[model samples]
Target: MSSVTIEARHEAWPLREAFVISRGAKTAADVVVVEAIDGAHRGRGEAVPYARYGETVEGVIETIRSAAVHISSHADLTRFLKPGAALNALDCAFWDLESKRTGIAVSARAGLPHPIAKITAFTLSLDTPSVMAEKAARVPHLSLLKLKLGGTGDDLRMQAVRQARPDAHLLVDANEAWTTETIGAFLTAAVECDIELIEQPLPAGHDDILADIPHPVPLCADESVHTADNIETLLGRYDAVNVKLDKAGGLTGAMRLVAEARRHGLKIMIGSMVATSLAAAPAMLLAPYADWIDLDGPLLLARDREHGLHIENGIIQPPDPQLWG
Candidate 1:
């Protein structure tokens, strides 16, 4: 094992300038990258601004800096970190570093045969019905599209995208924007559109309404399902769960979530924040068991760190660890 030193850095990217979302994100993209260096090997990981988690680039940098002293002293990746953006980045960097050191793949480290690249959902950020339809039509070889839903009239948006791309699989992410009354109408439209899944329509604490609602699309728990401890309460409410390494805190929590979610028959979706490729690489281990994939973090970025994961069309390839440990 090589002695590793870790450092964290932040970068800002300007959006297309006109791009905006219901979440009020309009011009800038900021992310924090964690780098772990050992001898000639360097591994990297990045995390985005998780609005739900109150994470800014500076906050994540501060969080990682607080742990740098502890992480640099520990050689074991698994025991070195906790979960969240800071730990997620560092944990992934450690995995990348170890993979390079051992001359084996990340799948081999986790006892899997090989990393199988799978079709992922291309996201259509919140936009006008016509604009979203146009965006959806442009994505090539895309079987799945995750539509960001949180506007006044999602039925029109959903119908427009569906009409535009009748052959593509569709899913909706409301980002905790639905009310009890609007959910029925929203779901009705999704059912008519033949949507496959709906994620976190209602806010977490008020999601009890889902228990009685008859949803045509399978419901996926995103904000509702964080760590392994959440699976029990989430059993009857959601048909699937979105597992992001950031929310799970690190690989240790994510592995536990996969087992616990399966024990309850909840379908798994390995998701990620709008991070660089480095952040999504480590979570690729969960790909084998996931029913859905949303590792499109780097795809959303203007440019990724060097030697990032390869993405072609909608399929995400395995990571090249030369960029991060």
Candidate 2:
């Protein structure tokens, strides 16, 4: 009488173009995939191992494999794995497995409304002012744009992109590349560029400077806050929190952070690391609660798997069950 079986593997998908951030560049998204099988039902989950979080694909798969034998239920998953890429994949797998076995959608199980199509922020990789402007111009149809910013000459980059796409909603992500000397000027540039939000202008654990800075544009915490427990400490520093399943363990843990953030009056940004639609699908369940949606991962890929989430222009339709919940 076999109960549930677990399996995990790594996959690499080529990017349409190099994804450049303050951290560096990547031409491919290497992801870890988790599977849970029970009788004739099968569930899947995908997560990108982020190097910034010190997670590698090999390490993530190993962790999942070692803990697989002990995981049979949601509570068992939590007890066996700590929060990270490994746990996130397993948690999401459990969600899909439950939905498959019980015939209940994830949103219904969690008492949330079914996901509807929504517009998402299309990201422009970090580049020179002129290059960034050209990239922004290429996507003239996209109404929302998220710019990957590097500190030294970011003001000109913002001005350039904004000039090219005056009709677009602008969001800036420094990826913690801005220094104290540059942050002041950068904040002013965001105002001049009509930027709506800024993410992680300074490094985590070194973001105290944000307390004294006057935010003409709202700041959102990406690297600073991980779990629900980190919300209260970020009160004055950030106006919002960016929730990524990779950072929060999975949908289960992300909901905890979302609830905590709302309680403290912090707005939410539902975001993701560049991966396939499989990874993006589960995050969409939380989209209704977000002030901004940055789940354009599939659009950045050279090609995605069949039956993936359908995103056209800048609007994304909810995931098809053939893909996942």
Candidate 3:
């Protein structure tokens, strides 16, 4: 077996503007990048340490450094670390390294078809109804728009956005800001606004109310579902799931979740944290299996990595091997 070396670093990329959600706002994306080196081959991966999940940049880097001593192979790395941003970075680095060493695309190694360019959902940050509408009007060419909504005046926000871009398909993400009682009202407004999906209207553990309600607009679980282990419990409550590598650990776990979610007839949505194209590339591989794609993280940044995934009129081009697998 060839010897391996691991290095990790934290990078902060400024966002074009503040990305506001129900929880709060962020001006920059602080991410941990992991690089695995084996002889002449090198692999790289990036992950954002999410504060909502009790993750910090320093903590993630430490976790990667500690795990590097024991992880000699990609297979070992899978079971070596728990599902989170730390493992995600290392896992993706392994995939990238293997791809470079063997000259095989990561998709081919995973038994997935070659990915093609696809339309991705452009996100509109949370703001007042009129501000949201103005933002929506500016991106008229984008076929899909994912709106960030707070519990209050969410209906008005949806209405204004709908009025601004009548032709675009809309997805609403409340980010667990709404209560069980308010979700029904939101769904009612979603229907009126012709919204196709409403994501994580209620908090994760408080989603029991979903089982008893009638869903006019399909509800997608962002926080309520993580890896495949959480899928069975969400069968009746959620119509779809938002899979992010940061949340699923890496492509390995995300693929498992995708397969399991599909087996249970749940719709799939490939989502991302506000990170760079390196972080978005791995998630794009799963876009083929997803009903909704939201890999617009790099587009939200002021500048992205060299040779990053290309986005033209809201469509994402496949990643170059140099950028990632």
- Candidate 2, residue 148: the lDDT equals 97
RMSD after Cα superposition, model 2: 1.1
- Tens digit of lDDT per residue, candidate 1, span 127-228? 889999999998857889999988488999999999999999998899888889899889889899999999999898899978886767899999898889
Which residue runs does candidate 1 get wrong by more than 4 Å?
1-3, 14-21, 26-28, 72-82
Please provide TM-scores, in order, for all candidate models, with all chains considered together.
Answer: 0.91, 0.98, 0.99
Model 3 agreement with the true structure over 33-138: per-residue lDDT tens digits: 9999999999999999989989999999999998899989998886679999998999999999999999999999998878988899999999999999999999
Clashing pairs in 2: 88-249
Q: What 10-residue stretch in candidate 2 is worst by lDDT?
A: 69-78
Q: How many Å off is the CA of 286 in candidate 2?
A: 0.4
Clash pairs, model 3 backbone: none
Given candidate 2, what's the lDDT at residue 251?
Answer: 91
Candidate 2, superposed: residue stretches over 4 Å from native: none
TM-score pick, better of 1 and 3: 3
